[model samples]
Target chain A: MSLDDLYQSIILDHNRRPRNQGPLEGADREVHGHNPLCGDQVTIRLKMDGTTITDVRFEGSGCAISRASASMMTSAVKGRTTAQALTLFDNFHELVTGAPPAGTKLDGNAGTPGMSNASGESTDVKMPRELAAFAGVARFPLRVKCASMAWHALREALVG
Target chain B: MHRSDFPLLAASPGLHYLDSAATTQKPAVVLDAMREFYETSNANPHRGAYELSGRATDRYQAARERVARFFGLGDPDCLIFTRGTTEALNLVAQAWGRRELEPRDEVVITAMDHHANFVPWQQIAIATGARLRICELTPDGRLDMDHMRELIGPRTRVVAFPHVSNALGTVNPVADIVALARDAGALTVCDGAQAAPHMPVHFDTLGVDLYAFSGHKICGPMGIGGLLGRRTVLESLPPWQHGGDMIQVVQDEFSSWNVLPHKFEAGTPNVADAVGLAAAVEYVDGIGLDTILAHERHLLALATDRLAAMDGLTIYGPPAAERSGVLSFTMADVHPHDLATILDADGVCIRAGHHCAQPLMRRLHVPATARASFYLYNDESDVDALMRGLQRAAALFAVAGSASD
Candidate 1:
């Protein structure tokens, strides 16, 4: 895979102008994630309105993949229910790692986020199209951690 | 100067490996020696009555002598074979630190030290109830001499520092630091992982009581390294680990430890890699460390000049004159990992991360830096490739930045 595939225009844009890049006000759940190999750190703040996440923000220093993923994560999960956010996490995990999410049977998406599976069942929680830009990360195994760092933090926040 | 000596470099003409500070590519001669040892002299040393074991014992002992001579150590007994610098340092910190340090005693290490040199002392200090004092760095990343003087005071029991900074390529003044530690009546320990490979190092003349280095960084095999220490200092410390070869005799009641180097080398040692490391030592000595140093300095100078000329790029540490072969830098708006990935696509390898020196990274005030370290195998072309890759990254980021805005 070429560099453009990993650093898609969307990724660069998100990296250049990361979205929701500060601590959420009155955050109920906050979790910090670190990639020890690359020293990429992400602190995710979520303002929970009961089960639904009303606001999400991430602040940290990371490479393009990680920072962009975190920015997109906040945008993706802001108004999502805790369960839906976890489903999205499962979908996103499969997209980058080429591995099925443990204990979560991905609906119809074949772990490809938006792509159709043989069963052709539609996933209730689909990954945002912009998040699919990280699909190429599967080819670069070392970068799977970078692409999944923020998502991992999100999962930790919601699950906890 | 001798790129062809390394088979991987010779095979892949387009590939540029700039992460030698992490581990150097071994030359053909070193590989051949290792293969020869396994093929002919593979046996457990010192246990059997067979000739092969004797041969293995001889080769392993001979390798120790060769490594000792390479470091300019007069006595081979003072050198203990370790897996790498980390193990050697841990040995000193645990064995010596535990024995000597008391509550309120101070262990001084520099901010520029790699984790191998830093964490061991920190842990030892914590375990022994001793205070760990960190010597700060100057703006250019050299050790602060005045701070060094202040840190090594009456309570200071041990002082550990790196001979060269792995992240910043800062060549520290070992003699000056040793002098301060000596005046304070503290035992001096030097981490020579970066220095042993790049330049001439005289372990005996440096006046450090203990020095640790890895073989892989010096063109030798992995899982093999050495710690050079003063014989008296090494003898005073009890064995940190107890195992097969390190014991003199095992009684039902108690056990006695083996002699100098063997007492520290617990397990059935890495004999083949030891033989291979000796071959590597011989290969490096044949090339002449002065020649290697000169060649690396030229490459460092060229890279520094070209990188400094690039827009929005910052080079860390002292100028090229004071540094060894390492060159760490960061491009504005591009994270070091991004720079590394872009460079990887161009077949120019580099190291990007905290470099296992998170304290130093905190000191530098950057999360991490992109490091393109050169070695004897590298030449002007590698630097050209690195520059080209940086330009490409800059161009891509510029377009992306404007489009996003």
Candidate 2:
């Protein structure tokens, strides 16, 4: 695909004007990620209400891919149940890593189109579905690590 | 360097190839040897009673002997084939480091060592609980010999440093460093990855405990390299890997490993690539090392002179720095990646970023650098293309930065 497809307008918008930024101190969990390839660094924070994610924010120094991904992730998962949020993480990870569940079409929205909404309603968030834009990103091998750095660091925080 | 000998030189759209420090282009002779091997005696080495195996084994052993003679060693027994410099260093880490290392015993390493040399020691140190002490580098990328002298005391058991820095391209005085390391009673390991490709290397002259160099970097085939250590050193280290070929006898309760080279080499090795490497080394030998070193020095002097003249440029290393072809530099405000991208657009292949030397990169106080390395194959035209590429990078990045603003 072209740069236009990879750096879609929405991704660029998130990169240019990130949604949740700066430090979130007193956060239940905080994680920092670094991509040595392009020298991208990010610090993500999860402010939780008991076991649920009450708020999520991040601050980092990185390229467009990492910054946009972090912003999108925090916005998508804030106020999510820890377990529910983890499922979203697993799904998004599969799309980026090319290990999608069997019988799932390669199309971006073929399986489980969007993340669950807070009202217990399901809205088809295009940003979450746009993750397949990174499926091609994974094929490069080196860039796969760059795309996955944020989620990997998040997992480290929750687990460790 | 003559372009007629190399077809890639004729095919690449333009010049400014500074990545030979990573890997050099194959000479006409090296290519011919590979072709001759495949066309004539392509067979598994040390396996069957056939003319092909005999010829193949002859070619493979000749390469080992060639390496032994090239390093002025007494026997080919000292030369062990490995994947590359990384594995060679790691072999010592596994074989020697595993046996001798004890808790609280230390491996004295230099900060300037390439990660290949650094990480293996780090891992082995972690596994053995042998502490790791690093000798720092001067701002000019020279090993702080004083620091090495101090750090490598009686407690220090191993000392590792590159004979030449792959990133800064500063050539170290191995003989001098080895003397100090030896005085401290630590076995010295020198990384010859950048050294062997550019200049003549004689391990006997350096007198280090172990010296490792890769074939691919010297226009040889990939997957073939040499680990030159004294036979006694080899004897002391345990066989860290195991399987067929490396063994002598196997019983229900006990097994014995093979001798010297085969003990280290546990399986069917890269027969073809080993033959190809033998050829590559022979090609270098026929050219005469004096001619090769002179050609590289002449090209390096010219290229570094051209780069030193650029405006707003910051070249890392001393003026008249004891350098090989690898030259790392930075330009005002233009990131190395941006510079590399612009140069790539003009078909100039150069290495950007940390060169896998993160600590050294941090020492330079920059995110990364644009590196232009030279090889014997590169000529004035290639260096000129690099100069033009840098100029293009400066202008285009300047324009792009302003336009983005």
Candidate 3:
């Protein structure tokens, strides 16, 4: 419940200078996500090469949690294949919602056997350490939406 | 007076509640009255021939009379008991707007109106192919009287506006707006959701065709509100809802409606909550609306001066003399949600969002604002807590800024 738990140094840094921000050119997939309760909005655009996500970017206005989550998500998913990105998304979603990283070790350890994506390949991917900074958001139930806004948009863009 | 009346406030001793515009905490007397109703006269009103039903009917009728007197409505029957201001306004839009409005007719509303007043008219206009005209606000966020004078014309069938802007706290010129609507041969529906809590509302004196106010905003229970309309106007509009209580005769193919207020109230009305609202009315009257208004004005003035002194802070709405107890503001670097969360850490509760007035937020060019609205229970100490909360949030963001450098 402490503010420090939710607004860690990493979150504030990402929010202050968000990485991979603004619009992407010739994006093959684009999606918008909004949390109507607090008016947090994010538009995610992706440039895909076959199943690989070559580049990703986001643009919008929101609270520190939302902006920082989007920045970390773009940095995590860049240069990864679509299936790996989806797996990372699943791991990140679990991390923020108070669930342990189920099938993957995101703390700089080797990956475990994970679920497979649409390509029938093992979706076990390395969880980026930076994305784990948002685990504290699970304590503040209302802010889970702020932390997951970008991931929801990324899910829609990739799966849909 | 120090939070003893409301159990929630009593439990959370250090909580600085500034979201009165959303809903006011109920007093002990209102709660007791509702409990008393259940203990003594709990029965379906106006149905059974038993003594308990008669007593229930009597209490319900008495609550209606008390509400009518509180709002200065001459005829208690002209007032309809609604779920809240939203339902009351919707009843007007459906019953009156649908029947009277035709294609090409205009329903003029201001940009300062809450969505409760704005959306219903917009939908009615769209449904009837009527033109919905939006009057602009002045630079200071007051309803632009000059713009209203121009927009209201012969074709303007209705003019619905809020007595106070929930987002900006601007106390609009109700008399002027009503005069214009009257001149154009149009009906005026005044949204009194915010106004009735902070100030005394004399519905008949306002010269409005219809006025709506919620119970929860004025220390009453939720799910109960009052809507006052002219007796002739009430008779003219058909009932928006029809069921057991609102009918006079039920035929095989056709049914006749009941008289004035009952015609609009369908099914089993919220009688216990109505009694609670009556008790709330008495509680506020005991405090004297003028005294409450003055106390709130003092708190608002102090908060406004303190907030104005802070750097990178912009306060919306008119100046202190012209506005109500609500204070909406935004800091330079902190989003309202972040600010509100930081404030909550200090037990300072303030609203942070569009205030259900998205159009007003767009007009002000802010994604959202943090609003601190005061009521009778608030004092100078509450304002001090708010100031401290703002400073803490600002300092946190300032540290974040320097860390990035």
Candidate 4:
């Protein structure tokens, strides 16, 4: 799909029932993120195994890009190993930052190795290429924080 | 749309300014008054004794008298000129909070207070080794009266909060809250920042021991505001800031402070801003706060109606009738920043973020929101313009991800 179509889908899905609209019961982890100027918040919850992400969910509220982004993130990162998830995180950041594909986006980074989940969805999708829908967020400098809120919350849960 | 008298209404032509809650547009009269001061009466009043000096003093003191009466204050001497609400609050925290409280004593403040009112008392409490108590508001934005009564006992020394919440637009029951604290033997401090510009806040009638307001938000010049202390409260508290024009005697070993208002005003105060504020107060008073409030309320109601009617709009703050002009919201899938940017393109300005109330945001369970705040300058046209902007923003987002479609 074109960049525009990708963005439309993201918004459509986000506007529908948002992923993790409310908190999960008996969840392993929960962390909060907020933007102080306009008062938006989101909390992240992750159920992880020894070396694999067992289940990933988000429970919170925010604008379209953020809520939808969290939904997409939950979809994209689940069942992936920690190292692969980190690479996807890096690619997502690079995509929003508009970095050249010469490094990560262009290469068959996921296919050359065993980067698929139990469902066999390739972990090698350089999210920047697919997630390029959020590039418009980069055009508006202030919205960058909205896109980053979930990512930041997720990073805290994992690295900690 | 824009008030003709306000220069900043269309200051950046086609600029949709939604940050009035932060500050407001300055009217031409306020600007002229300030310019008139600098051009004609540049002499320092109260300190200098010349022709121009006397003229300056006359106008300056007259402005003070005007503000005193505006808030139902009888004596201008009871009014202390400060930088703005922040400074006014800090002065009280230092002069009263420090001098009065014991190490284990407590000061009760709501969770919704702006940092200006919240932090000063916190610092003062820290300095005095006094404790700072939090009186969290209920989910619906009212002060928890039961919690308040439970909190303010003998150990509690003062109760401070905003008359209207800057974030929630909650018009707290000031008289009731003040009475509660007063009966508990505690001083009452009310930050009038959010309330003063939107409504007629009578300091004397509010019965708050100390009332603070900034001039800028009320279409006055920046850097000038006042603190109205009860006559008895003014008499008990020592002036916090010390310098020229605030001293009765300056001996080699020690110095004695001057009386009342001047004692609180140190150095060369914001004289020009004071003149502008006075002019602003006169303008609001002349227009009748009834009209200003009625107009703003109408605009707020119109905006909220249009927004709440939208397919995916979720709004924050009080109900349209209960809240003032501030309307915070988020579209179904559009982040507030994205909404604001798209709105900006449509020549509508708005503020997107936490609005300086992080705690309130946590309670609302959302990060950042698009806030279309109305003011005296905003009219029905602006509200309609915002409605159009929202439609445009939704349309823009609707077509965003079509990479190849």
- Residue range B123-149, candidate 1, lDDT tens digits: 988898999999999998899999988
Give each model's clash number: 0, 0, 0, 33
DockQ of each: 0.81, 0.14, 0.75, 0.25
Tens digits of per-residue lDDT, candidate 4, B194-272, equal: 8888888877777899999999888888898989989899988987978999999999999998888888988877778
User: In candidate 2, what are the lDDT values of residues B1-405, reduced to their tens digit?
Assistant: 655566677676465566888787777677788888889988878887988888888887887887788777777988999999999999998888888899989998777778899899999999999999988888777888888777878898888889888888888878887888788788988899988877778777678999999999878978889799888888777897898888899998989988988899988877777777877777777777778777777777787788888888998865433788777888875557546655665677888777878777767777678888877677777777788878875665455345444
Query: Each model's C-alpha lDDT?
Result: 0.90, 0.76, 0.90, 0.78
Quote each prediction's TM-score. Answer: 0.96, 0.81, 0.97, 0.77
**lDDT comparison, 1 vs 4, better candidate:** 1
Give the worst 10-residue stretch by lDDT in candidate 4 chain B: B396-405
TM-score head-to-head 1 vs 3, winner: 3
Ranking by TM-score: 3, 1, 2, 4
Off by over 4 Å in 4: A1-160, B10-16, B395-405
How good is the docking of model 4, by CAPRI class? acceptable
- lDDT winner, 2 or 4: 4
Share of native interface contacts recovered by each model: 0.86, 0.03, 0.72, 0.53
Please state the error at residue B318 of candidate 3 in Å: 0.3
Worst 10 residues of 1 chain A by lDDT: A115-124
| Docking level of model 2 | incorrect
Per-model RMSD to reference: 2.8, 4.9, 2.4, 6.3
